[model samples]
Target: MEHMDSSMDIQHLLMMGMDLYRWTFHDNWSEVVEQYKNNAAIHTMPINNKEDTALHVAANNNNAVAVKQLVDEIKRTTSAVESLKKKNGKGDTALHCAASIGSLQMCMCIIEADPHQGHVLIEERNKDGETPLFLAAAKGHKKVFFYLKDCCVGESIGLCRRTSDGQTVLHCTLYRDHFELAFEIIHKYKEGIVGFVDEKGISPLHILADKPSAFESSSNFRWYNWLAYQCIYVKPLRITSHSKSQQTALRGSTADTENPASNYISEHENVVPKNYWTSYDIFMAFTRFIIWPVWEAFGLEVIKTSRKKKEKHVWCGQILDGLWKHKDVAYVGGRVKAYVMPKPGRETDGPKGDAKQSADGGSQKVTADQDKLQGDAKQSAGVGNQKVTAD
Candidate 1:
């Protein structure tokens, strides 16, 4: 088991692959640890065409135990931080792999393995300029996204929260229909990202508008499902003023700027929930238990779907209100208006239908099309009967 550097040696190693890489790809943690005991270089050796090390394979495969073991083994023989920073062909580090796959355990294992400089992983962008935070949000991994987001502070905040294409995490979350998370991002980083426009000149508001199904007007539900939707109470989401003040204080603190861990605030810290169930909760639970079987038996998932749609609608409104209140409202509003309004030449001439089957049935006159026809007749028929033209 000699360390090889030449291309021929690398090819030979690829042909007769090392035991450590083999065990890692197949997820044999015990053998992987045993191999590390023999040679620590095995952990950092390129394992495949992608140049993925054993640690990269382990992290991508999401073996939390293996990742922890390998991180420890790498720490003893080499700089664990340097090994963690090693990028594959796509320039994705082990942390990026962990974040993309939505493995919170693996992410924590990798990042916390090097706490002093773990924030470096969060800030490191791939070839596409996507930080691990952007990948987490794009993949709809809320916990991993939050963990990576909490690691971002000051300048790293903007770097981690946005991509090279100028798309922010808010845009990704909205495009993925993660309305609740999008709403949280709106309030949390309103000053920086609420009004962000991507390279395509699309804002978060434009993305929200594209999701018509999120609005009540787009939902065509049955009467019963709509009733159930109204009955099913969803607790609205809001960030408390205390949390806002805390965020402000954290941003202003110079000490927190250097240490990403210090900027984290638990999601539950500001909430003081009631210990006992309310009467409404008891009643709702009873009603749900009684009718839940019928609801499921008939495959009437609309109740659940409706609840989700309503929640999305609520969050959408809240997000809009928050953005409207931001200092960049004029900019955001103008961008949204531009996106929503039909371009000068692209506007539809009128409603799609024939003149004979008009909604007013020949009684109404002076419609745009008819006015155009009348104007045409004025040129041809000399304008005398413009007011009395027959159908």
Candidate 2:
């Protein structure tokens, strides 16, 4: 001690502090922490490459005990809790890092350190504009999602949101086939769905209606299907009105070059039969193609019975007849007016049981068998210990 140079001694203590910070993040909190407690130079050491204190490293690594120790030291020495908003090299605070990792407890601790930090919790975007909520949602951390929901009370839930394709969180949720989380968000924020289009002009329903095969492949296909069905059925409310001049000028104008009126009646009248089917029609086409083919292949009798029963209903038959009479006026004319033809002795159970049983039982068995085969193949391939990866 008598011979040690002042600068060398200071450097030695700083180096020891850096090592302690590293060990704390490595989850060896007890050993090097005492050195941190005794050395004044420890608090000044930087481990985040941005000259941040040990607290920054502890928070980044989600080491709660280390954070507490650092906080206590700061309080005892400086007589005040240090600001939790200290930014690292990438402009991320401890809360941001905890959020990126979906560490709910760590996020709570940072917020508890300063309640005002809750706003910053989701508001903080990484270098890529991804908020903590976005990360949690994309990574499928249900707990983190709930935690953010809780913290967002009295604050805007729309904070720090970014879509994978640069849309809002609501828009991103719409494109997601798994609707459990998205439904929760929409229920809380009802107006969130309006005008939330993705890169395409396609709304949430349009997105959900697309790629029926994608839903079929998901583990939660039934839920996705139900949600997609809901999306398809719930037509958005129309609010705008066209000018009287615009409406009258287009009345009865069957000319191919005339602008179609915005009203549903005029639009339907003007649409060329071949072009009448929108994206919804196309989606339904693929959906039926994938789902109906399987049903027809295995349950031809059930399909026949369902079709016959549906046709036998007098109301349905009459509607078809009326549509056929007005074929020239309706878009898609003859093709759209075709009735469900009845087959002799092929009528049963409102066609309900047949469709339900086939869709439910057959699909369940097929999925179970496929899952079993995949598990066996994976085991044989020796990747059985690996985590199942999602697309």
Q: Which candidate comes out best when scored by TM-score?
A: 1
Best by lDDT: 1
lDDT tens digits by residue: candidate 1, 148-254? 66655543345534545667787888888776677677666654555445555565755655565555555555667667666666656645222222333442233
For each of the candidates, the C-alpha root-mean-square deviation to the true structure, in angstroms, is: 14.9, 24.5
Question: How high is the CA lDDT of each candidate model?
Answer: 0.61, 0.44
Where does candidate 1 clash, by residue pair? none
Q: Name the weakest run of 10 consecutive residues (lDDT summed) in model 1.
A: 350-359
What digit string (tens of lDDT, one per residue) describes model 2 on residues 1-391? 5456877887787678668757766777665556556764455556645666666677666665666666555545542223455556666666666665666555555555545545555556666556666666655444455565556545343452453343445446545533444444544443333223333233333333343322212222234333333233311212222233333343234332123434223223344465544665677688678966886788544444433322222222222222224232211111221111112123322212221121122222111232342233223222112332233
TM-scores for all predictions: 0.69, 0.44
In model 2, the runs with Cα more than 4 Å from the true position are 1-17, 31-45, 48-82, 116-118, 153-155, 163-165, 171-178, 198-207, 214-391
